[model samples]
Target: MVSREIRASVHWGVAHALPTVFLRRAAAQGDLQARLIRVGSRGTDEVFDLVEEIRARGPLYRSRIGYVATSHAAVRHLLTSDDFRTGLPTDQGPIGRVARWAAPTTLHPVEPPSLLVTEPPDHTRYRRLVTRVFTMRAVERLRARTGEIAADLLDRLETRASGPVDLVEAYCAQLPVTVIAEILGVPEAERARVLEFGSGAAPSLDLGLGYRRYRSVTRALAQFDDWLGGHLDRLRHDPGDHLLGQLVAVRDEGEGLSETELKATAGLVLAAGFETTVNLLGNGIALLRDHPDERARVVADPALWPNVVEETLRLDPPVLLTGRMAVRDTELAGQPVRAGSMVTAILGGANRDPEVFDDPVSFDVGRANARDHIAFSAGRHHCLGAQLARMEGEVGLRAVWDRFPDLRLETGARRRETRILRGFERLPATLRP
Candidate 1:
């Protein structure tokens, strides 16, 4: 019962496949009390049906979920909900089970035990400790540094041979890594290696790929741990102004974080900080390239970069999915969800929900509610680096446009194979020098 308008706007590209699978799986579960709602290319009709289904069956349901190969809902539900656990035993069998499994050790395992994985106390504790480091004030302080990084990147991009340049590699990918390295106190010379290692650690279920990434992540983690551990020891003797130095000084009645916790926290910050920001920059640039009018508007008024970034997140978020595990059977949106189920909140899909956003498909940089988008997520576990990411996006995009107002996308834009993190692997563009 999806609406024609929504259906018409359906992006039937490869990206839509996986989410569709989850929707279909939920529909096919064969549970009499639970029904799966299908919203096809019919737009409002489909959305209407989806709303009715949610109202009738409740938000949480018990069924063998089938998902569209690339639907946003499928991925979001898989990653962010308690009704579906990514790493747990599921009726989906080996292939299905392995596909969703998230290991703390893996960098990109179709799933991973990130801050997005755990719920309640663990999530609460981790979030509380880390949240302080990424506040608006802290992010504001980093603005100057972020601007410097953006300028350096633009300089590099400008100097590149005037023909088609891979924007993703030349500018998007490098900026965030440099920013993160500076924030984490990693030597500039080591930033590339760290990025390489962090990339390898990302979760990809392909056994060969996953194993290789795991090894790279492990080795990198060891090196980072050793370096940070030594740095912490020194900081205890002589403190500095960086995050790691500050973390070492924090204490709760003389009971501070264990070395393991510190290392894990630092690693998480480093990996999440740079990777997500990089994708955001890349995705935003690509979106502007595709939407010339919007790009022109932003270029004409650099202040609109924030809104542009926000709209880009709503339209094509870098982090496509996030997950949570159910501690007990509960009713969500009315449906009965068993205890220990996984609940995936479809941020991307939800952000685009026609009921929530008017003209959801169009990229409107001036949309009043653009900032309300769930790109940084919601609730207690919302992204700690939200402000930092925004600063990076605003400053980075402004720099790009400022340097080359006539930047145009060349043919052949391919998104990376990593579904969890949605972004371009390569984006060739011509900059008018």
Candidate 2:
């Protein structure tokens, strides 16, 4: 039987989703021994593999927390279904006890809601505001700037002409952060602080942080929020032609955004922008080095870079799993879901579903259906930054490989030790000819 504590915690929005995710994961592994698959204690690379193994066990498996939808059919349906929502149907407050139960037994105040964990109206509105910035037309305008950023980073990496390079730090990590910081018009002096705070708060998306880490994240969020408030205020006073100025205009027009919404939107954009591309660059480069035939093909014909991008996404997406809650009693892939109970949809499994792609396990850049993979997820909740992320990958990957024809892995990468974000902590490589 589910505890009343968890029941309350699970029923809310973005401000509460992390605790709910933590509770469900903890309960799923700790007590609900019904078909325990040992998601806990696995290394970062192994975690996605484990999810894939569960995915192979047919489409839908009833895990302790709601359902684990792994098949292409199941994941796509669950994400797209109107019956499932990112949050509970109601705001139903007084959830302090629930937060304590989710984390350690300590009081936690509600935080600003992110689009990731909000339902329609709220989610739709925020999505509209963000989509205005990332439409293909808008993203296309950034192409020249993004390409220049990528080339500059790669050029710097080339200066290291000899010895191993920590590409994760020197190239992969720096490129996306720089591009996003520029897009937001972040001051040159404050850019480092923004990413530093971003790095601290990022783990809020995963489990096993316990209380201390959660506290640290809360502090970072407040600091980032403070900086964002000032930044947005400045943009409002003198609207430029940048995305920040555009967002400020959105906020000032019509119903306009509340102070909370303004801050949350900026924070969400910053959070969404950085890590996805960084990890994608790291993962894609590493994959290219490991597979020389594919590497040679990609470098030999850079036009195939998009195909390479698609394949890398399908094989190792930056985000491994996403959660959805049942808004009303409904069935997913034949499993009955009760309202408010959450489901963990394993994207890694869905991408590799045999039903969707032939030779699913092996990475095949030429696979016709590579683009079909929902690496950015599906439905209204799909990544708003999808176009931007692809552009970054397209520019970043090809630039590095094309620039350094002899690029290859130097030492082993240190995986992030996280299950939710399947990526690397550091990736080392060589650019010697």
Candidate 3:
């Protein structure tokens, strides 16, 4: 165990600390992307302003880290083009060698076989299995279940003894976790534990953490890994008919994922399945409450609820940005990009590109092109649960307003501090007008 801790420490230095040093220095030198990353978290308006600053520089801004893509066209191209692939540029140095050797073997979203980092072939295979079970039709079928879950949660919210209640804790978080737990066959008794694990492990996607926080995150990850292994083992012995059970049974062509692959895939799906939607629900609720005029517009036109979700996603995305590395020397947005260069696509910024939408930052529920925003990302790496997330966001937010049309946000709503993912950690609100 001591040796494991040593390895993790060494791994953190190479994987996180080294880059953090350069990023902090670059941030100090006024590099917009560097500042954005090094700060780790920022207020909504300020973060957008920083992204716009990078955009104002040109289509692509080069920072000490690599290139940052903010324009709608540039970001779309960076995400969609074959020249760029997901994951950071490989480090082929002695430090890289040591880092790779010291890295933990835990199943994580940033690691291989998780689909987030895996390219074609394996990615195609794993995605195929998941898509078979997580299809749009499958998601659409769950809409009624999702709405039912929202209604049930609101009932609990209504029963709470008065004063400001945290909407994130009572509604936004519970609704999606319950829905996803049902989808993944997680027993109701174990749902809270799953949520805890996801919350603890979420920072694994970010960069540059202090050692104390890093150790905590690593422990959480290991715990989640052990729990999932047990869960999957139980499923293997007596698999049910749910999506994960089907995955366990190797439903697609009988080509099952190995235990590590299965664990990686399941962990990613479980965490990602709810985390982003948690952000989406919270962001949508806050956006609607803050923009009562648009909220009223949607209330009058019940059919616009779906559009409301799209518009919210456009104005304030759940995810801020994603990074990709150039697979080969290539050109992007008329600029030459060399092989191994990294391009950080600021999804939040791209959604607000003036070329795509009018008054890009304003919350417009009726915006016709709101769906054009790539909040779920694009190309081969598009979010597998996009439809499910949209369904949850639409149903969850509408349910809140439908149940309590006069719901008022309190003064203490707080945004989450994770660098890539954005949303509220706590959203205090009054159920009554």
Candidate 4:
């Protein structure tokens, strides 16, 4: 149980504050317990305590509002159910409190809309367009390319293999960017700029930053629009057989994507397809190095690739969380949520939900229900690049294992500063050649 004072403090001071500050305090306090909880003014402090409790106890636990907000019935209503649709509390303003506060540009201030942001029609439309190129069949075409990229990266790692190499920078991060760049027909020179802009634009999803983040993202979007527009123009005049060319040729319902929509769609595809997969590969490799037994199993039996990928996703998802606005005044679990409130679906937390997974903390590649995890999410907003991501992981891991059968993590591992994309900034590994 959490202390009442702490609960009250978090409820009053933390709920409405900037999430960065809130998470900072929470991290500093080292009190991240509770599962599937809400924190707001009034009784929201309890949510923080609950989060801490969940962290403390295991992966899953119940949450309750502070003493003042609701009855025992209301508390029960919020918990003991999976109807996340209703549990979110509603906003009470014109712009909608969440929209005002949780601007995408403010939280990350960098990075782009990589499937985590955007809702409904826009999300659906963009997802549909990219889905055509990112399909399992389409991604299969990249198998040879992905293998070549992995082999080239490994070759580079071996050549410059002095001291401790950051596996992330050397291999994981580079692989996806290279692959996606080729796929999207982005010029080699512009790849670095595209990555920088995408990364800078990602943090805007945190609801606390709101308009501030949006402004920054808009600027980045403008740059991406300009750069990609020129790229598209070149592709139009001299069409290549790449994914972007296909996108340009696509006409849905006799209505092709507008110039702005095409750019936005391209931005989304590149950002999501490249960044998240890079992080996933990076994180998965790190985890393998950390857990030797798992690595040995993967090396011995490449057949376990799918399960290994699922377990990796379960333990460390690339996209930690996603946001959605309520379409209607609905009840989630048992909470009263008004229409248009912001909801942060904790994909990381949800994947580790004990009720859904056994021994959630442990890394078991062979876990029976591992595939049921929501690393790709559910419903209309599932990742369009899911198949592509899986293929990348399998190819990357297989190539690494086949090339260097005795790879192990060096003494030190450093993670990236960004929390939204969970992976290594640098993972020093020794390849036994």
Q: Per-model C-alpha lDDT, please?
A: 0.62, 0.74, 0.87, 0.61
Where is model 3 more than 4 Å wrong at Cα? 251-254
Question: After superposition, which runs of candidate 1 have C-alpha atoms over 4 Å from their true positions?
Answer: 1-114, 204-239, 249-254
On a 0 to 1 TM-score scale, where does candidate 1 land against the true structure?
0.74
* Candidate 2 per-residue lDDT over residues 1-433, each given as its tens digit: 8774454334333344454565566656643212222343233555655665576555776665567888888899999999887753223455644443344221111233567776678877877766777889988988999999888777787778687888877888788888888888887788778778767776666644544555676567667767787888888888877777887887688465666776777787887798888789988988888788888777677788888888999998988878778878998887788888777788888998888899887777677889999899999879889998998899888888878878768667787655567677788777885
TM-score, per-candidate, Cα-based? 0.74, 0.86, 0.97, 0.74
Residues 1-433, candidate 1: write the lDDT tens digits: 7553333223121113444465456457643212322332211223323433442443333445322112334334444554544343342466444333322232322333355545566556666766766889888988998888888778777777478899877788788888877776777777777777556555332122223343454455556556656656776765567776677777322554555566666667877887778788888887787788888887687778889889988877876545445555654544455665655454556666665678987889998888767777665556778898888889888888778878888888776655356667788888983
Off by over 4 Å in 4: 1-122, 207-222, 250-254, 334-336
Q: Point to the candidate with the largest TM-score.
A: 3
Judged by lDDT, which candidate is best? 3
lDDT of 1 at 355: 56
Instruction: Write down the lDDT that model 1 would get.
Output: 0.62
**Model 4 agreement with the true structure over 1-433: per-residue lDDT tens digits:** 7564444334223323444455446445543421222232112223434433554543222222111111212222222223333222333453235433433221121222333445446656767766778778888988898988899889977776555567776777778888889988888898888877766565433333334453565467557666777888888776688878877776322465765566667767787777788778877887776788887787687788888888989878876644444555766434556565544455666666666678877888778888866778666556778998998998887787677777778866765444345666567777762
Model 3 TM-score? 0.97
